[model samples]
Target chain A: MTNKECQWGGEERGILIVLSGPSGVGKGTVCSALRSMSKDLVYSVSATTRLPREGEIDGVNYFFKTREQFLSMIDNEELLEWAEYVGNYYGTPKAFVEQTLASGKDIILEIEVQGALKVKEKFPEGVFIFLLPPSIDELQNRITNRGTESEETIRKRMTAAVEEISLSEHYDYIIVNDKVEAACNRIRSIMVAEHCKKERYLPKIKKWIEEVL
Target chain B: MTNKECQWGGEERGILIVLSGPSGVGKGTVCSALRSMSKDLVYSVSATTRLPREGEIDGVNYFFKTREQFLSMIDNEELLEWAEYVGNYYGTPKAFVEQTLASGKDIILEIEVQGALKVKEKFPEGVFIFLLPPSIDELQNRITNRGTESEETIRKRMTAAVEEISLSEHYDYIIVNDKVEAACNRIRSIMVAEHCKKERYLPKIKKWIEEVL
Candidate 1:
């Protein structure tokens, strides 16, 4: 956004927010609360080859795609980051994200750690945040209590959670989800604080100095 | 302090805050408001060779020092940063600040630009913040209208203000003091957000991951 239109007084285009963690870390809930609180946040919809659920709407949930369409996107290099999970392809569309940010709106991409790292490779300026449960016991409780998954799947997910937690150090911020509201508040504070970082706002201040001096 | 003693959730020792700005930028007003708002913050008491005004208390206002003691502190390297101003020595006492932070209390040192850069050289981990007035006009008004200072002194201060503002790019955070309360709130946000930085809390999270896995 132009410096005049910036809410955080930054002269940069917009921030790309990348949120990642293991299953049942409450990324969806935190993002929901964040989007509800911030009117300017745009959620990046992932194009997936998985079939839609009974009531899930296309685009509103995932951008439902055939395997052929998803493969085509990958071949055309249109996806920011993508991976195959449980025989389904899931990836973030790059064009929409670029447009949204170019229009001066922040966009959040909720993905797994692998995808997150991949996106970071392509977009190093993105704010990468890894969300975690308060403790291992809490994470286990959440995963086991999600009822829809089989016991075998839960066991595998627990193993994966440990690996994901280990990779959190690579992210810019690691937020422990004690409560959705508190987690959201901390994320919002990070957003505000990042905007105030010296590098981001130096140009605007320099402009002010130029005018004043 | 041990990481376990930290209240902000990071394992690192309490943050050393370095606040610097031009003379007429209302640093005192903002700091007063900040102290009242955050009872947890400890203001670093500087040792000054200048005689204290009648009502100012020792240790609370300043650690009133004789010129000889001040020179001794310089020789002993007992000051984090020190400078001579108006024929008097004013400097942050190293012993008190290190002691307070060892007890897990955040200490804020308010100094000028040169002292701040010097502190950064010695303690590179400090969270340096440069405060600015809302506008040049407001800064001029504040300096010129301070009835206690002569016009020549005001002119000198204005010149210093420009130079200091130009050096702000080196600071970690920059806050514009439009209103004391707002400035205080932003500073508070920076404190909270700094605790969330991945680098600060990685070891703690790593311990958690090791135990959980």
Candidate 2:
């Protein structure tokens, strides 16, 4: 890092901010708000064997891949985390994340709790934030307000949310998704603060001191 | 600790932000800017055996104390860290800091690197930030700008700064003081992010889930 870049935001590796939460929490809304707030953050594109829906652009929306290509990627260990859902394979390509970080561009990964935990195992340094509904009642209201679901499905989802929230202890940070803007701001602050972490800049500072001072 | 307090600003114990750096690193300037930016942070007043200077208020500026009082406090372990300088004693009172934090009010302690390290030993959870000049040359310029010092004193201070900076590895974060506003922003973000730390809120979250969910 140059002396001018020493101010901040000059890290050689970008931070991976993983957003996860229970089903009813506003992780998607918060992530979208965060994306609008900062152009510096890049949203990680997922690679999937599922066919791209109409109006979806490859590489922009998802890295559309054939079943054989996805299987080859899995064999080569090119994916960070992969899941088989509804007979389709979906995964995050390790190459894009690693390249973005190497180029000093931060990437945001919004995934389920299990997927976020899987990412954590691969990249322990990633900042994992668990988005939470304001209250259990609030989560119930949100789940019910999505009127498309049956009562049985809502109950099942609520149980799943509680189970997912239990695993929140493994996350690095917890953000209550009471307000979308507030949650996004918390995420923004976390990103800024993570850059200031001692481990990220200490070696560079040490080298700078040795060479210049 | 409640559902209403589950958001980012609801930490039970206020954070202790300890700002420390080498001499001429603009720690004071950055701290002052931070104070102006947020009224939520309280400045920790030092207890001193030295007589209060003109216009200095008791308790507000410094907690004035007699030599006996200071010595007794030291013996009683009432002080977080103490130093005897120029025939007088000065120290941070552990009570005031603890009381402030327990009241859910964050306190800022701007001290020398040695004093900061001492506080860290006593309260390792404190957020230790090492402020740095943009570059070694900039640090030299800042030191030289203090026109009252002799050339010999300047050289001594430069040596001291280098030695002090070497201890920055012990700090939790590093902020380059290129601009006071920017440095203050980093500290603010750090304060915000620290509140979101999972360890601070996970227990409450778990209890909330158990009792309410």
Candidate 3:
């Protein structure tokens, strides 16, 4: 009964949580709030062939690479999932995510629906979460209020939002981003609950039983 | 979007949560706290073959029944789970639990390990929780301090507690009975998180998608 054994000693399995959403759904804000609360989680950085924007660090923001290097990665199947946009290629490097998880840290990959599907294919154990606006009207208002894009761009994004919302069924969890704090708390609760799963705690329980009995 | 549909329908599929612990581990206190916070949850009243001692109601406290009736239930397999103690049979009835769950109300069943295993065999989806004392020495002290049992009974119960703790591995979650409020809060959090699982919420997501798309 006085045993001080650290019961769960198997290789630390990392939780891979994918956050997917339509534009202007406040997914970024909710994720930021979650990050502020939990320091053990890491956000995955995407590798891209496009040039880095102003004040963006190469490895921190995006792992900027040449077109030849990106294509070579695809040829070698080193990328877990990849997609092309405009004239550049963007993909998640398999090694980075695997290493982060192996070290017992949770990793969040913020990707679009297409890329999210590919990631799920590559890592079947990853948790997929979809963020939604409270309503279509609220979605429109949010996009319009951002004022960062031209009216034409906003309209195009709105159309894409509709399509993305239609695919929310593919996600494991649907969080309505009506309020950032509430959404973050719900996500955090999910994380805590996952940790208490019987399968994950079985080894510890087995050891406790063997020693006591 | 404002439609408030009971996504699971009136065809309720409520969860059955089983709480078990050694005596003096504060299980009753924790259950009372949980009930106070979650008024919607129904605590299942068990049936017993023992004669009523005092002002106990048939349905509210225990469904006091004749020994022949209890034996008849056993023959008919109407009891979800039961056990014999001191020449009296105590058990949970199947009809009441099923009817309550079908009405969309969560149910809590407080029973011992044997009864828990029986219920698990019948309903594998049920949530099984084990309450643990802080330590073996503390458990001995708590039981001894109760002053209701003889020294021989105390020793017997302590040995039983050890055996029960050894079987804690079978439980889905283990709540340490350090503080009643904290344990109840964790239980509530687990319940809320279970509701958010993909298997339960996927239908709502699909319906929303089909309607909007």
Candidate 4:
């Protein structure tokens, strides 16, 4: 079939990209780089009841809300996925994600391994990506260099990192964050490759075949 | 778990890679490039009953077998997949593929869509890749430019090309052969990424978690 004859119909499926990594592997940096490269991608702003930290903006970093509103969402099952953490509620709203996807924009969700599994359950088509540090020493160095946590916390976080790394098996793809550009390129390539899958292009292929034949 | 402590186990599932494209799309060229980059890859040699065209080596280009052997294989279901074209039989041996993968080598099976789909049915975990020319015009130009086929044969081949392209949607990945090096890089990256999938790494991950915790 001729490529020109193939007509793309309706809204393309919104790709659900789940990014998870060790705390210091720079997943946020890779995600930001990806966002800068493609404006069509929407970073899914998670909903939370945690008080906005200093300089954090409402609806920008998160949809910060009252405990009542958060509980109400949970009650109505409006959130695609949610989790209670450190006595505060954090969740992904269904409406915004659906709206963003319907408009043909890809959504990127940076969440932990556990949260990612929950999101995957709700959206089975979501693409799961696990980011890894080059080595344990590198991961330790990065965590220590951050200076946000004490020695005890660092050890605890490292233990948690190991647990998270174990869940790496559940992810669809794993990117060892040896270099930001290289990792971002892999992610971008995966996105491009996914779009070319048979399920996505069969209709167009069929139409093109009929025209050329 | 540390890389030193992590043991490669029997749980690693085999990856089935299917390579297909229009004639002269350089599928063989790309496959050769891929093999050069990874020495552990096992290239599946087809079992065929065709007389060896000049310079064709038995068990290299194909497993040259007699009609009786080929028919017996088909009857005994020893072939993973097979197809008859004109007066020759071509099939992939099931035992060789299973043995190659069990030894941890990535298997690359260069087959047509019919054979590919049949193998996929038996091994649903297979990765299917379709190679395409940069454009339809370029494809037609390449086919005609070869001067090997007459006008009538070219027309028949073009129709067949359209049919094959229509089935491209069944593939997991579609690579446009615009540039050889770039296509090779993407294909290699895909193989690396596939190896890092959670399904392949989960056992190691589970062990790592146990060690750390």
- Ranking under DockQ, best-scoring first? 2, 1, 4, 3
Q: Per-residue CA lDDT of candidate 2, range A117-137, in tens?
A: 999988998999999888778
True contacts kept of each: 0.51, 0.66, 0.24, 0.43
What tens digits encode model 1's per-residue C-alpha lDDT throughout A60-85? 88999999999999999999989998
lDDT string for model 4 (A68-114, tens) is 99999999988989999899999999888888877777799988788
lDDT ranking, best first? 2, 1, 4, 3
Q: What are the Cα lDDT values of the candidates? A: 0.82, 0.87, 0.77, 0.77
Model 2 Cα lDDT, one tens digit per residue, B1-213: 121375333577888999999988888888888999888899999999999889999999999999999999999999989999999999999999999999998999999999999999999999999998887789889999988889999889998998898898999988888788888988888888998888987777777678746
Candidates ranked, most accurate by TM-score first: 2, 1, 3, 4
Badly placed stretches (over 4 Å) of model 2 are: A1-4, A7-10, B1-4, B7-10, B148-150
Error of 4 at B144 (Å): 4.4
Model 1, B84-157: lDDT tens digits are 88999999898988898787778888888878999998788889988877777888998888887887898898
Model 4 per-residue lDDT tens digits across residues B43-138: 998999999999999978899999999999999989989988899999999888888788767789987766788888887788888887777888
Q: Is candidate 2 or candidate 4 better by TM-score?
A: 2
Best by TM-score: 2
C-alpha lDDT (0 to 100) for residue A132 of candidate 4 = 81
User: How good is the docking of model 4, by CAPRI class?
Assistant: acceptable
The true-versus-predicted C-alpha distance at residue A121 of model 1, in Å, is 0.9
Q: What residue pairs are clashing in model 3?
A: none
